[model samples]
Target: MSLPSTFDPSRALSLARETLDIEAQAVAAMALRLDQRFVAALELVLKSRGRVVVMGMGKSGHIGRKIAATLASTGTPAMFVHPAEASHGDLGMITADDVVLGISNSGESEELTAILPLIKRMGVPLLAITGRGDSTLGRHADVVLDASVEKEACPHNLAPTASTTAQLAMGDALAVALLDARGFKADDFARSHPGGSLGRKLLTHVSDVMRSGDAVPRVPREAGLMDLMREISAKGLGMSAIVDADNRVLGIFTDGDLRRLIERTGSSADLRALSARDVMHPNPRTVRAEALAVEAAGLMEASRITSVLVVDELGRLSGALNSNDLMRAKVI
Candidate 1:
């Protein structure tokens, strides 16, 4: 689409700034009006044994869907149901245990108000988010939340601009209140979003990403430096763990250790004569397989190392992982 010949860059920028200012003020005004009514809405939703049935019309419906998603992700059971569809048999989705949350700018949206009586007859509590507390929807509501705005940000005062913003803010306010009331935590949020990065950081364990069994680089304490280097190179973990006959972790030797060893002994020294026990750093950083992968990353970062040895509760060498493994798993 081409811009109109009369389109003024300064005018467009001014309108954009004014729209944001109007929306910001609308939300701020709603915040000031919050009182016992807002509390009633929160308590109503919290006490319900069923989900929150959100309903709206037109632009409000679009906001309702987003609100429902936010509520569901934040530990609240909620879903959006189009108000217009309610009259078309979609009303069956609402249970008696559920709470009906209606959104409208005028509080008399035809599609939304038409079902207010049905919702009430079903013995379900109604929560209204609207501009007019005296309007039909608010009159039928068990709890009314005022989402009023002085005017629309639209130049003609016709579009649902600030009004819709207020409705969205009210929905977010309810979700956040209910989330805190239920003691929702970051881990709970991550569980709902398992495919997200937060889930990888919180749910992934060391055992889930670490190389185990023969794949782990390990050399007995009596092993020669040549064998130790071979294990490190073969495992490609940039390190090798030194263990005893019982496979209990004794120490770890990494590329850094090898570099410092060579630098200290000089090229003329007999590097072949060094044993695993003589070159390895004793009691190297180790993490339990059951621990979170993020915890292993923290250990490596704090110790200034690239890799860490995984150990069992008995301190036996079980697996190994490096920064690369964490990056692959997206836990770092």
Candidate 2:
């Protein structure tokens, strides 16, 4: 067709949507075709003590990186090794206990094939994810997971679109299966991703972010309001726990309470005359020092408070955390 003088925006969008629909169907087709070979591949990876070395070339290499990341974050230790790099001595990273996952749309990437013999010689298990089950790479692999697609999303039917999507999804399936088999929990995932918000929610304990001991803003029940404000200012937690002689939390005096008290009594003389017990909000929210930081965040949000007292098993004050702590730790 000749080019139109003006562009047809709807036609261009329809073409893009058609491509996505084709790829989506290709992935859906894979679910029904998953067989025993997929199980065997997962078993090989899970049983290996060393990491999974994922390798590919061209577009396959991009997908390989994502697969490796997914595997590493989901209890399976994995890293991407380019086939070209492998031929240049990077192959030493692979160990006998590791599994080699080679991805190829045509099942015949020459760079990948060039290093397969050496990987095989090292006694490392070889797994192939490819569009062709009868290709040389598939035939040589110990286990093959077919990632075939009927057509490419490319208008010319040449680009690696649907094929790579299938491969990526298959890799995810393998990683999740290994994760379940290994009984990998959220805490385990948090350990690997400690720098992110998910890690803060799962791995950060109350003790990790809470203010401890004397560092906690606290005042005795009989202490004057000025003394309580001094403690709050020094600790900078926006609230002070009012404890008794035994150091057990009796009530909490917060900035909000202070504001309300000031509104009612027009003088600093009246505020100074008030004792901790006289101005405090009794039975303030508290959390155990061992609780998850995420739990603390929920308690704060539910009570519409900015801070909570961290207590021990016996209900004695151990530490304190406010909205600031949650923000700093990325738990919120």
Candidate 3:
């Protein structure tokens, strides 16, 4: 068969568009079919004391892994198991306290159906996500989630395109439902994803990255101009807090203030007369040590300041943090 040399690219684009439209319609149909079985499935998994054991074959198995990941990340504690490997002893991973989620488009995948009886015998609640409600796996399931699609997006009508997308979306629905049921908070997510930027924003506290003790770049209110500059250089926070004898912050001396002071004073003698109280910016921005790093970043941005003094509940200076610290913590 010779293909037409003058074939338009628009024809191929139209076909692709039609395929997606059909898939979207299929998913919409599935949503309309949702019933009490969905609720029962969620209850079964939510009541399980152990993990959600997800099992499937081929493309369904790939979708199962993603579903399991979403469940685990949202506090459901799920893990995917390949049905092909289950007969070889991986079935030991499932326990009576667990709920088994089996995904099979036809609901009759030989590998998946073969273990249905075993999962039943173990007293594990089996939830099947399938197109055919009368399939062997569905018949054995305690609850069935209808992930049926009218047809595949493949041109030949044989690939797992629309069905897989529906399954993925349904799996997300389950994960999100479970997340809401468990009251999963962003802090809980941060604990699980400590390496990501979201983790830094949620888990990082001001105390974790704040400059403390001698590194806070603090000086007494009576400190001389030269002494304040030395403290700023040694601390490298670009600002020094002027504190009282009790270590309570009274004012702040920043590099910006130093520049303005230099411009106003024509000579070293004029600059020498400037004490901490005389030149310091009084009532500078401050934050609590227990505040979020992101909050610190906000305070810096709103005040147009580079550094903030970290104070305790009693208003005594405890530490300091600059934009650099926020950058290092990935909070900015």
Q: Give the TM-scores of the predictions, in the order they appear.
A: 0.90, 0.86, 0.87
**lDDT to native, each model:** 0.92, 0.91, 0.90
Which ranking of candidates, highest lDDT first?
1, 2, 3
The per-prediction tally of clashing pairs is 0, 0, 0
- Regions more than 4 Å wrong, model 1: 1-3, 298-304
Lowest lDDT 10-residue stretch of candidate 1: 230-239
Q: Model 2: which ten-residue window has the lowest total lDDT?
A: 265-274
The full ranking of all candidates by TM-score, starting with the best, is 1, 3, 2
Distance (Å) between predicted and true CA of 309, model 1?
A: 1.7
lDDT, candidate 1, at 45: 92
Judged by whole-model lDDT over C-alpha atoms, candidate 1 comes out at 0.92
Q: In candidate 2, which residue pairs clash? A: none
Cα lDDT tens digits for candidate 3, 217-249: 888999998898998999887889999999988
lDDT, model 1, position 136: 99
Which scores higher on lDDT, 1 or 3? Answer: 1
